[model samples]
Target chain A: MQEVLRAHLEQIIPLTDEEFTFIESHFILKKYKKHQFLIQEGMPVKYVYFVVSGLLKLIHTDDTGKQQIISFAMEDWWESDYQAFYTQTEATFSLDCIEDSVVLGLSLESYQTLCEHLPKMEHFFLQKANRGYMALQRRLLSLMTSQAKERYQQLIHQYPTLVQRVPKTLLASYLGVSRETLSRLSFGV
Target chain B: MQEVLRAHLEQIIPLTDEEFTFIESHFILKKYKKHQFLIQEGMPVKYVYFVVSGLLKLIHTDDTGKQQIISFAMEDWWESDYQAFYTQTEATFSLDCIEDSVVLGLSLESYQTLCEHLPKMEHFFLQKANRGYMALQRRLLSLMTSQAKERYQQLIHQYPTLVQRVPKTLLASYLGVSRETLSRLSFGV
Candidate 1:
């Protein structure tokens, strides 16, 4: 699990063994069963998780209890109610497992400490944040420009693995389409 | 203009005079009138801009020449075809002034040099990126969950100044509604 983290970090910034050890100290490993909640809505978001195995969804539940999957995270991905985590506020979104999962969790304090102690980690995180920002920008643009069926096709074309793994209902929510509409489209596709 | 950039950077990280000078040297200031294009679709993106004054819109034009606004930027904000700028690819979106604008343009090479030479800049950029990601996430969620009327209300409530500054057609484009609908809604409000 730690090796997975090391490799993920190395993808952006090479880490020395000693540096990796120090970095690893800031994170605690945790495991969850499918459907177990990592961060619950309205509760304090304590840590941001880096997935080691399995899959998770960042979910937003509306006033009527309609749950929407904002995004998904699998192995090598980072998941959090980020606005809440960064601001130390109550989680607006809940994170839960789509499969039995293992993750390395880092608290806000630990994240700040790590960056302060090793500026290289700041560089690493900046790279990650920039990439994440770019992704969100693309997603926002897609939402603004594309129709539901087009978005579904775009998702399938770009993330065939994710499309295969995510349940249709959740995918429908993510794509802003009705379940029946998604069903018809998926059947046709 | 340089002071505006310095003040924006200082909001995240303190910079010495020497440090600010070093940072300023990497940016080139340019002015554009309303409707002038800072970036055009399919052109190689050369710089990521930090707005010193006035407003800009990031726009996407579909095959039929219909345009949709992806986002807007004002004084103290940053705007770019970031996907293109970062990847060194031709821009899929165009950025143009909505108001007579002044911006500091930082080339990718200069960006790299700034981050490498002054790691604080990386931290500053990380903070900005995180905030941008959160904003995009909120926008995406709103697009998924809200009706056009509700989104228009939310925008008016959240960004009153922007609502006042932007034209109805662009606002309608941003809200994914027809101009007539937006005009009716605005008149009622």
Candidate 2:
């Protein structure tokens, strides 16, 4: 568990063993079965989870009960309804495990404590946030300017691992298109 | 001029007089006449300019020379083709002054050097970058989900001063709509 956490931290910033130990103590190891809901809309999101080995989906349901998949996270990625989490509001989105997986959970209070105790950790979080914002910007632009085919191609090319792990229907949902449209695009010549 | 710059810096993080002096040395006051381009597409963007006064527009053009307004910066706001500036590539966007204005220019090299030399400055820049990213995220979401009138309202609500200074045509361009549409919306019974 420590090794997995250390590996993830090392990708963003080099952490000393002591620092890693300090963080490890604060994190809670969580196990979830496939298709399990980690969070649901209208409930408060108490924790942000880092996926150690599973796939998670961040989704939102409209008034009509139509789910819009905002994002998918594979191993080493973090997932949360951050707007809700940070603001201490009811969740605007839901999180569910797509595959049976291990996760490290960090509560909002614990994350704040870490930021106060370790400036480097704060820097790492800030960098991750910036990158997330940048990627989302590009994704929005693509969604507006490109067709479904182009968006699909970009997605597969960018996150082939995610494409491989998820079903075509879920992928279609993530792409904000009908499953039939995805099927036609995939098999239509 | 120094007061405005100091106020801008304080909004993110407090700085000592010595630190402020260090930052002050990096800025060069530049004046632009109305209709003059501050930075043009395909050119190397050397500096990020903070508007002491006046209006600056950032625009992106397509292959056929049709332009799309991306953003506008007024007093206390900083403007630059940051992606191009950071990557050392030719700019994909253009910045032009709509009214004669004074701007404090900080060259990319100097700003980078300061970030390396001053940890506080680096933190300040990181936080500012985070804020900029957030604004861009909101803009993209509005563009994707909101109608033209909604976007126009959002823009005016955020920057009423810019709304007053910039003309209707430019405002229409910024909202991704036509001059006639904006006029109709503004005057519709």
Candidate 3:
């Protein structure tokens, strides 16, 4: 699990043994069972999790209790109620495991300290942030301009494994389509 | 205009006169007339513009030549075909002035030089990128979950001036509503 964290970091910036050790000290490994909540709406977001294994879903529940899937995290991906994590506010979303999972958790304090002490880590985070922004921009554009079928096709093309792992009902929510519509599209009926 | 850039930077990280001067040198001041393009589809994105004054729109045109407004950038906001700018690829979208605009443009090379030579600049960029990602996430959620009217309301509440400055047609496009629907909603009819 620690090796997974080190490998993830090394993907962006080369880390010396001592630097990797220092970086590792800032993260805590945690495991969660399937359906376990890692973050709950209205609770403080204590840490951002980087998935070492398994799957998690981030969702928002409306006043009417309708759940909207915001995103999913799998191996090597990061997840959090980032608005809460960054601002130290209560979460407006919840994160729950879809599979028994292992993750590396970094608290806000540790995040700041790592950036302050390791310039390369700051660069690494900046790259990740920029890529995250770009991904969201692409998603926004797809939502604005693409139809449900196109979006589903995009999801399948981008992450076939994700499409396979996510239940059809959840995938329908993520695509902003009804389960029936998803079924029709998926089956080409 | 330089003061505007300096002020924007200082909002995140305080900088000395010498530091500001060094920072300012990496940017080039450029002015565009209304409807002038700062970036065009299929052209290499050379710089990311930080608006000193006036307005800009980032748009993508589909195969049918129907345009989708990705976002509006006003004074103190940054706008670019960021995917193209970061990846050094041809832009899939175009950025054009809505009003006669002045902006400070930072090239990729200068961006890299600034980040490498000034660690604080890297931190500043990381902050900006993270905030941009959060903003995009919020917009994506709104697009996925909110009705057109709710999305319109969210936009107006978030950027009242932007709502006023953008034409109703573009506003409708941004909210993913028809122009007639926007007219009806705006007038509460």
Candidate 4:
């Protein structure tokens, strides 16, 4: 499990055995059953989770009780209500396991301490944040310009495994289309 | 103009005069008239601009030649085809001035050297990137869950001055609504 995290970090920055050991000490490992909530809307977000295995979805429920899929995270990916986690505020979104999942969680204090103690970790995180920002920017552009069918095709092209793993209804919600529309589009393709 | 850059940096991390001077030396100041392109689509993105005065719009043109407004950057904000800037690729988006604008431009090499030589600068940039990511996440959620009128309202509430500054058609483009729809929404409000 720890090796999963070490490998993720080392992708952006080289880490020594000692440094990886130091970094690993700050994380607490936990497991959840499918459909269990890692973060509940309106509850304080205590930690950010890095998945070692399995999958999760980040969801926002609007005032009218319509649920929107913000994103999905699988193995080696990080998931959190990041605004809530960073600001120590209550989560406006929820994160739930799509599969039986194991994750390494890091508290805000521990995150700050890790960066303070090891500057390279800060650099590594910065790179991750930049990449995340770029991904979201692309999503925003797609939302602004692409039709539902086009978005579905783009998603499938970008993440064929994700298209296969995610349920059709959830995929529809993520693509901002009706399940009927998604079915038609998928069939048409 | 350099003071604007210094103040922006100091918002996240305080710097010594000598350090500020060193950082300022890496950026070049340039001015552009309204409608001038800071970055052209399919051209190599050379610099990320920090707005000292006036406003700029980042735009994406679809294959059908429909233009979508990605975002607007004004005083104290940084704008670029960041995907291209960081990766050193040709820009898929173009940035153009909405008003005669003065900006300080930082090349990728200077950006990297600044981060490598100053760990605190890296921390500052990490904070900025995290904030940018959070902002984009909120926009994505808005795009997913909100009605066009609701999105228009949210934009007005968040950036009232921006609404007043940007043209109605561009504002409509940013909100993913037609110009007539925006006018109706604005009038209704």
TM-scores, all models, native as reference: 0.97, 0.83, 0.98, 0.98
Docking class of 2: acceptable
The digit string of per-residue lDDT tens for model 1 on B138-162 reads 9988887887888999999989999
lDDT, candidate 4, A1-189, per-residue tens: 898898889889999999999999999999999999999999999999999999899999999898999999999889899999999999999999999999999999999999899999999989989999999999999888899999999999988988999999999999989999999999999
Candidate 4: residue pairs that collide: none
Fnat per candidate: 0.90, 0.18, 0.92, 1.00
Weakest ten-residue segment in model 3 chain A by summed lDDT: A136-145
lDDT of 2 by residue, A1-189 (tens): 669888878887899989998988889999999989889889998998888998988887766677777789888888888767766899877899889989999998898778668767776776676567657756765665567997888987899899889988899987878999998877753
Query: Candidate 1: where are CA atoms >4 Å away?
Result: none
**Poorest 10 consecutive residues by lDDT, candidate 1 chain A:** A140-149
lDDT of 2 by residue, B1-189 (tens): 888999988987798999899999999999999999988989998898989999888887766677777778889888887667666789888999888989999897888677667766766766676567657756765664567888888887888878888988998987878899999877752
Q: Write model 4 residue lDDT over B64-177, tens digit each, in one string.
A: 999988999999888999999999999999999999999999999999999999889889889989999999999999888889999999998989999999999899999988
User: Model 1 over residues A1-189: C-alpha lDDT tens digits?
Assistant: 899999999998888999999999999999999999999999999999999999899999987888878999998999899999999999999999989999999999999999889989999898889889888888887887787888899899988998999888888988888999999989888
Error of 2 at A144 (Å): 3.5
Off by over 4 Å in 3: none
CA shift at B141, candidate 4, in angstroms? 1.1
Any idea what lDDT model 1 has? 0.92
RMSD of each: 1.2, 3.3, 1.2, 1.0
Measured against the native two-chain assembly using Cα atoms, what DockQ does each of the candidate structures obtain, in the order listed?
A: 0.83, 0.32, 0.89, 0.93
TM-score of candidate 1 versus the correct structure, residues matched by position: 0.97
Candidate topping lDDT: 4
Q: Where in model 4 is the C-alpha error above 4 Å?
A: none
Which one is best on DockQ?
4
Q: Please tell me the TM-score of chain B in candidate 1 relative to the true structure's chain B.
A: 0.97
